[model samples]
Target chain A: MREAALSLFSRHGYAAVSMRQIAKEVGVQAGALYNYTPDKQTLLFELMRSHMDDLLSARAATGDSGQDAMARLEAFTRFHIHFHSQRPDEVFIAYMELRNLTPENFEVIEGLRRQYENGLEDILSAGQSDGVFAVSDTKIAAMAVIAMLTGVNTWFQEGGRLSLEEVEQIYWDMVRKSVAANP
Target chain B: MREAALSLFSRHGYAAVSMRQIAKEVGVQAGALYNYTPDKQTLLFELMRSHMDDLLSARAATGDSGQDAMARLEAFTRFHIHFHSQRPDEVFIAYMELRNLTPENFEVIEGLRRQYENGLEDILSAGQSDGVFAVSDTKIAAMAVIAMLTGVNTWFQEGGRLSLEEVEQIYWDMVRKSVAANP
Candidate 1:
């Protein structure tokens, strides 16, 4: 049901989709959806919150424990690109449906997003302290790096002119230099 | 009518907003709207295409004529941040409503966007040739820089913690170092 809702919400706006449509897409009664999510808002919030949770959990799993700041930053870049690329629908909803989220729900999702961004900022801060990265502001730098990396989803296709590995390499090189004290 | 439509389209996804709602928002009857635009899709396409045209024109006005590549790049970074920050709704629709454009409209808008991006790429390519930048792929670098800069609209508030000037300086610093042959 959540999968059906996600597809509908992403293709059609969340507000445009409803219980009946989602239920129809799921091949179930509209009442059955209430058994699962209770309401459309819940469904939207769950999808966004879960995406953030999954992102953080996955980041934890990809931890470069005891690594240098540079290495950890590279790990983050790779992990972010790979994770977001695989889940186009979730990524689309996560960004596009923010306005539709209730305030409390938006906070939860935003908090999780901040935590994820802070992970990268922490790396930048550590690198700055270690005199490896000459970032002016670690917070802003983290956001800049993130937006740059997440942009892969906009144009990346499986069999494009460049392979994912090639694209990754290109972005990684730019990411490394973007914050490097001496490239 | 375009303003009313743009606000509606950006707030509600283009697919969700109807011609009746737009006409009401513009203080006109539904039948009267056809005199201005043939249909909702045309309104969306015009809003999007005009945005691109305006962006390109603004960019041209901010062009770094007879300047070095580094300065030109800096001008672009600052100009892009300032221009996009002011038109939050248009920027939002420009990114979010692409999925709703007709295929032909999509291509026209996409082509205009490419032209805008190519402007930045041209700067990067020139910088590379001039030995000021070491960008491996100028195309990807332009996109990365753009995505990073445009992200300001996602979180920027009028009286936020950082002034626009300050934010511009921070991003410009990162952009310069990101592409610099030697940071």
Candidate 2:
């Protein structure tokens, strides 16, 4: 049911998609769908929450923070691109469906987002303290870097002019230079 | 009617907005709305096209291309942030509504988008040729830079931690360093 809702919500605006349609997609009775998620809003919130949780846990698992600042930054750059690219629908909903989430759900999602932002900010802060990254504001730099890396989804295709690895390397090069104190 | 449609479409998803609601917003009869746009799809297409035209004309007015590559790049970066920051609704719709456009409308919008991208790529290409920038792929770099700069809209709020001018300067500094040959 969650998958069905994510697919539908991503393709159609959340307002345009009916709960019945999600049930149809899932091949379940409409009443049965509520057993999983009480409502479409809950489903949307769960999808967004799960995406954030996955992102944070994936970052933690990388153990990149244990490395030097530059190494950690590279790990983050690559990891972000790799992670976001594989989940186009979830990424779209995560970004585009916030307005559809209820106010209370919105706050929870925003907190998760802030946690992710802080994770990246911490890396930038570490690098700044090391005198390797010369960003005037680490918070802004974290936002800028994540925006640049996540942008891979806006145009990237698997069999496009470049492979994912090539794309990753290109972005990392730009990101690495973008922050280095003396590139 | 067009203004009403833009506001409605930007607030609600395009698919979720109805001509009747737009008419109500404009305080006009539902039938009268058709005089402005034949249908919701056409309204959406026109809103998107007008946005592209406005962006192109605005950039042309800047005459950034006439400057040296580095100066042109700075001009582009600052202009993009300033322009996009001013039109949160348009920027949001332009990115979010592309999928909602008809196939033919999509083609026209894509062409215009490419033209805007090319304007930035030209600067990056000029910089590359001038040996001032070290970008392996100017096209990707152009996309990356534009994404990063336009992303200012995502988090930047007036009277926040930084003024718009400060934000522009910080982004410009990062952008300049990102592509500089010897940062």
Clashes of each: 0, 0
lDDT of 1 at A29: 89
Question: Residue-wise lDDT of candidate 1 within A145-181, one digit each (tens)?
Answer: 9999988898889988888888888889988998988
Q: C-alpha displacement of B177 in model 2, angstroms?
A: 0.5
Determine which window of 10 residues in candidate 1 chain A has minimal summed lDDT.
A159-168
Candidate 1 reaches a DockQ of: 0.83
TM-score of each: 0.98, 0.98
Query: In model 2 chain B, which range of ten residues has the least summed lDDT?
Result: B59-68
lDDT string, candidate 2, A57-171, tens digits: 9888988746989999999999999999999999888888888888999999999999989988999999899999899989999999989988889999999999999999999
Please give, for residues B66-87, the per-residue lDDT of candidate 2 as tens digits.
6789999999999999999999
Question: Comparing only chain A of model 1 with the true chain A, what is the TM-score?
Answer: 0.98
For candidate 2, give the DockQ. 0.85
